[model samples]
Target: MEYVASLAFAKEKDQQDPLNKFREHFYFPQRNGKDAIYLCGNSLGLQPKNVKAAIEQELTDWQQCAVEGYWAAKNPWLYYQQYCSKPLGAILGASQQELTVMNTLTVNLHLMMLSFYRPNKQRFKVLMEAGAFPSDQYAVETQVKFHGFDPESAIIEVSPRPGEHLIRLEDILEIITKESDSLALVLFGGINYYTGQFFDIPAITAAAHKAGAYAGFDLAHVAGNIPVELHNWEVDFAVWCSYKYLNGGPGAVGGAFVHEKHASNRDFVRLGGWWGNEESARFKMEKGFVPKKEAEGWQQSTAQVFNMVSLKASLELFEAAGIGALRSKSEGVTNYLEFLLQQLNGINFQIITPKNCNERGAQLSLLFLDKGKEIHQRMTDAGIIVDWREPGVIRVSPAPLYNSYQDVFHFYEIIANIASNA
Candidate 1:
């Protein structure tokens, strides 16, 4: 598709979009009696309108059924999270038994590390991208320290070479091969949050397996933004939160994936709780832990019904508009944004995100030579919602689910004006 020249052209494209009606299903935040041009789904998605009904159903059930609501409500609060599995599995490309919704993002990461990061005397090292999220870095460091290993000595942080914006795939493969004897696990983000770089997950998984190491991913930024095939990729484990692209709510519950290959491995150590016990035997209050036979075995508490109701509503939307279709549209929207950015010649702005479509999702991380934060503030004052990262990067994500081409064109128009004045 050619770059759109005006806001009217963008509106024409929106009119032709098959998923255009979905925009109405969400609760878009407004400023000055007008809908804000929201382009920050990479940070937090807009709330779905159906979420209220879902929450109300549970509230009504609770009032009428009381204690029986656990097993007797309209949707059965006892098994509320089960409703999430099938749709979530379809989104992540895993079987129902391999995925479950529970816990927060960092908590799930710690749980998976307990089961997957089995460091020993010889192979006592972990490998991860150098610039992973702060929460992930803390989790990994704490896990390393828990195992009596110093973070400086046991963690291998792989970073890009000098003056490069992204890590090279070949360089990562080389590290995996060279450290095969000592590496215990390979953990990485499916999409880097700052630069919006989408890593080669399948290739990285295969490389880790070849080196006799476990492979895992933090899909916080990639879950609803990109297409993933965790089961086909044979990833050992993975975790993600729902607030960003899933639009559940702020600090919403997260999900986890444990490949079926490890499902029956009773010897795999895990941090357990009563909720993880097999449902058939759970009420018996048995002395010993008899865990469930699937990924649900990782659960440590009762389902958070309200938060999960929000997620169920959002997942239904994802099910209606398949992730593959969304990703195809995302590529076009992001590429169009890039095309518009490139037109501002001699404007002292640079795109730090990877140029190749396969290397990114919907976000474009723009670096300004001067006054980056000021430009971001100007866009916000104009009722445009973009995010500013420290040290001079601003991220604009035109979400395929709700953002329109007109929104992008208007943003570029404002940006061009800002540049002219600067």
Candidate 2:
């Protein structure tokens, strides 16, 4: 993975990249009638070229079949979610019975909490990383309050030591041991949005289990960006949104997972819905809920056909490329970004993301001590699209599916010129 800070070198890497042709699969934003250098896939992914055709097919089905589209449509809307299970199961490292597509992230988080976060006199607190995505913080806080506990006291957050940028593995494990008596659940984002740190799910799950607590993850940043073994990790449950690395279009359908051990436990305390019932009994319009024996039991309602078609289209590309193939490309491109950024002598910034490839995904958070926001605007003006976060960070991600080494090199060139001027 030797990298050179030259356009020809960048192009050469792109030329050799087996996944480089995937750039054509996405629609990039236009700048002066040309495709912009898009490094913001960690925010909102580029649209798949096949999305329109996929949606149009559904549109045609709805028009021709009307209400009968549920059964008569090409994909059969009644069981539309089944279409995604094969690919998604591979990405999450779970069996088909252990995972299912469902509602938005926070909604699914609340649902998982309902079933997995049951607490008692000796164990009622929840342990999570500090600086998690705000929605997670809110979900955990409200869930604690729902069970009649004060959030401040009921929630334990592990933070980095002073002057440190990332949480240490030992600290997390030690805190789990120290708080084992009170911890009812251990929840975390698979990858921290701001720091772009990929937590060790296997280690985290083992610690939580040893502490006599259930473990879950919000995988919004982890799903398609890196490889995981959720079933092998024995995580109790997990949830994720599909828009970011999954490239499922904005506000796409979300996914949820539970271990197979819990999938058949009809007595589990889950918030049930009509669609979640056994399919044979579902149409009987019965009075009581008889849940399905699989992850489908957690479903609340019918699939959102329109919302899922885009994801279906995206998943096809993922299946063809394979998660392992994508991860290899992701590492190469992200390393190229780090290499170029390091060559900049005085950029008034430091990369806060973990330097180890396994410790991160596709993103690099450039923490600028000064003019971070202004530099972000400059990046935009220069037709380089990246995300900006509070305080002073420019989050750049060269998504392997649609971004190239040239994209990272160009970002470095623009920021370098801006830094020199300052």
Candidate 3:
């Protein structure tokens, strides 16, 4: 698809977009009294128009039904996970029995590690990418320490070649083979936050299994941006936060996936809570912890219904739009963005994201050679809401659900103007 550098072309694309109606369902932020082009869904998504009503419904249940609301609410608070799992499972490519909404992203990461990262003296090392999200780095560091191993010795970081920004798949597979004797787990971010490279999950999972190690992923960047088959790939476990691409409000409830093979193992070692106990036995309040034979068995507390309401509301939109259709729109719009950016002159930057659409999602990470912070500020002030990371990378994500080709064109226009002045 050839991209034109004019606003008319962008508007024409938006007019023809089958997903255009979705843009109206969200409330964008205001800058200079107009809806800002919101390109920061990679950070925090814009609020869905229905979220307020969704929260109000819960509040009304609390007021009218009191504690009975757990059983009587429109969406039974007692079974909130089911409401979330149905739609979320579709986007994540898993069965409802294999997924659950629970604690935040890092907390779920810790729980998955505790259950899966059993290490013997011979095979105690954890293999991961060099620059994972900081939370993952910290969690893995502490988990290895808790098990009485030196992090430097127990953690194998697969780095990119010195001059390259992305890690090579061959290098990761080769390291898994070389360190197979001591490797206990292969954990990775589905898409690296900084570089926006979508790793090959199925290949990585197979390699880890062949090496006699468990494979897991933190899918915070991948979950709603792209469709993934966690079950088909036979990923042992995966975790994600909902606020980014899922369009749940800030700090929304997080989700987790445990393959049927692992979720069905009631004897799996994990921190037990009443919510995780078998429903029939839960009211008895007995001593023995008979866990459910599903992913909900990992729950450590009662459902945070208020926190989860936003995600449930957002999933309605996902159910309507479908993740496959969203990905198709994403590839086209993101490609248009790339094309427009390349047409810009005098900008001292390089797109660090993988060029292949299959190797990325809706994001493009621009690594600037100079005054990156200043340029980012200019973008924000001009009502273009992209995010900047340290070491000079600005993340521009046009979420297919709400953002438009016009949004992308406006972003390109701002950058081109900034380049001209610089």
Please tell me which predicted candidate would have the highest lDDT against the true structure. 3
State in Å the error of residue 221, model 2: 0.4
Go through the candidates in order and give each one's C-alpha lDDT.
0.90, 0.91, 0.94
Off by over 4 Å in 1: none
Candidate 1 C-alpha error for residue 205, in Å: 0.7
Q: What is the C-alpha lDDT profile of model 3 across 1-422, one tens digit per residue? A: 77889999999999999999999999999999999989999999889999999999999999999989989988888899789989988899999999999989999999999999999899999999999999999999999999999998999999999889999999999999999999999999999999999999999999999999999999999989999999999999999999999987889899999999989999888879999899999989899998889999999899999889999999999999999999999999999999999998887899999999989999999999898999999988888888989889999999999999999998898889999998
Q: Single out the weakest 10-residue window by summed lDDT for candidate 2.
A: 339-348
> Residue 184 deviation, candidate 2, in Å?
0.2
Clashing residue pairs in candidate 2, if any? none
Off by over 4 Å in 3: none
Model 1: what TM-score?
0.98
